[model samples]
Target: MEYTEGVVKDKETVIHVHPNDYEKAGNSYLMAIVAVIAGMPLPIINLIASGVYYLGNLKASYFVRWHCIQAILAQTIIIPFNSIAWGWTLSVMLNKTEPTLYYGIYLFAVILLNIIEFVAVINTASRVNKGENVRWIIIAPLTDKLCSKKNKSPYPLY
Candidate 1:
């Protein structure tokens, strides 16, 4: 095990993790990506992944649990947003309306959001695999709050 400064260690709490287990912990993110892609054209897969992470890993270490909770929380937000976007697109299609400027902007925004999230998760997972703490700006506080409130699990060597 090693102690590494978190992404915002100066201001945020630092987490200690084991090198071998960091990548294991980050598997939650990979699962999230898989769910998102597999459930594409339908927005429910995010919920499935989120549920699996939150319910299936209650006994995971604090380090793994933290990342899992963050991934779940992010999926919670993204799933609904995607559902709404798809619904909007469907409504437009049903009404036979010409794609408007707003639609273009919305499409661009969704694409941008997806790209940003993909990059962030990949970067965070890679960093965490190296036994470094990584934080997501929007979800970090929530992750901390939830993980702190839960029973803290000891870091495992494996």
Candidate 2:
């Protein structure tokens, strides 16, 4: 009777242990897959959006230049960093590793970049609303040669 009881108790313990192990293994596998899928899209999306914005800005109408420039700048600096951070975090999580100090630095850099970008965007918008020139707000300098004034007749003699 004692031997049978001990054997039954040991079997029960083994059964309990096996289920816990299986649960942990299943969770780990799920987490790894989720991390990879989540991380992979970020950089690709950033690249595509930035490229499209940059190209669209190249031929933007005069009235839309300010908004286009703001979009371009946001895409250029903010999106890429954001994507990198996501990728880094996902990689660390998938590897079951703690985030390093560099992750904090990357986060800080993203914040600072965003703040600067916000200031730039606000300044550009204010200037545009006030009917001031906005060429300087953009990354590239606008030349007088490219101005509409030079391309049109000063008087409506025609």
Candidate 3:
């Protein structure tokens, strides 16, 4: 496996991922998914769960930490869009806001984006669990920037 920019061409980890670490990293993505389902009423809960996973895995190996950050970033991207939709939904239900063509269009867009994100998360989590380092199109660059080799993790990976 060729390592370049913290990514494995096929498979590898700079810090030598433990068998379980792979699962942990993959699970970081899944947590957000679980929260997404359970917290449909409050979309922010998914982000919160992913954030907590990131914090808990702060000391984990680079591979694990990288995946955690990616998961959180994914949630971060959808939160605002989801929030707007949720708020609009609440407003409509409470009869505080009138539904309109614009609202329907916007809600449809948000739901489409959310479904795409959901599929991406599931695919990424599955790959990570199988010991593959998946790089998300947008989230990867940001994660690499935030969790850099320059700022080495304080705790041991093993």
Candidate 2, residues 1-158, lDDT tens digits: the string is 11121111221231111222222222211322233346544545533543454354343332233334334444455566767777777888798667889888887887687567556555655554443334443443333223232212122111
* lDDT (tens digit, per residue) of candidate 3 on 100-142: 9999999999999989999988998999888888898877888
Number of the top TM-score candidate? 3
Local lDDT at 15 for model 2: 12
The TM-scores, one per candidate, come to: 0.78, 0.45, 0.85
TM-score of 1: 0.78
Decoy 2 TM-score against native: 0.45
> What lDDT score is found at residue 41 in candidate 2?
49
RMSD of each: 3.8, 29.5, 4.3
Instruction: Give a tens-digit lDDT track for model 1, residues 10-85.
Output: 2554444455557766777777778767877877786688668756777666677777888878777777667777
- Winner on TM-score between 1 and 2 is 1
lDDT at position 118, candidate 1: 80
Global lDDT scores for all candidate models: 0.71, 0.43, 0.82
| Model 1: colliding residue pairs | none
Worst lDDT window (10 residues) for model 1?
1-10
Q: Look at candidate 2 and tell me the lDDT of residue 19.
A: 21
Which is the better candidate, 1 or 3, if ranked by TM-score? Answer: 3
Residue pairs clashing in model 2 are none
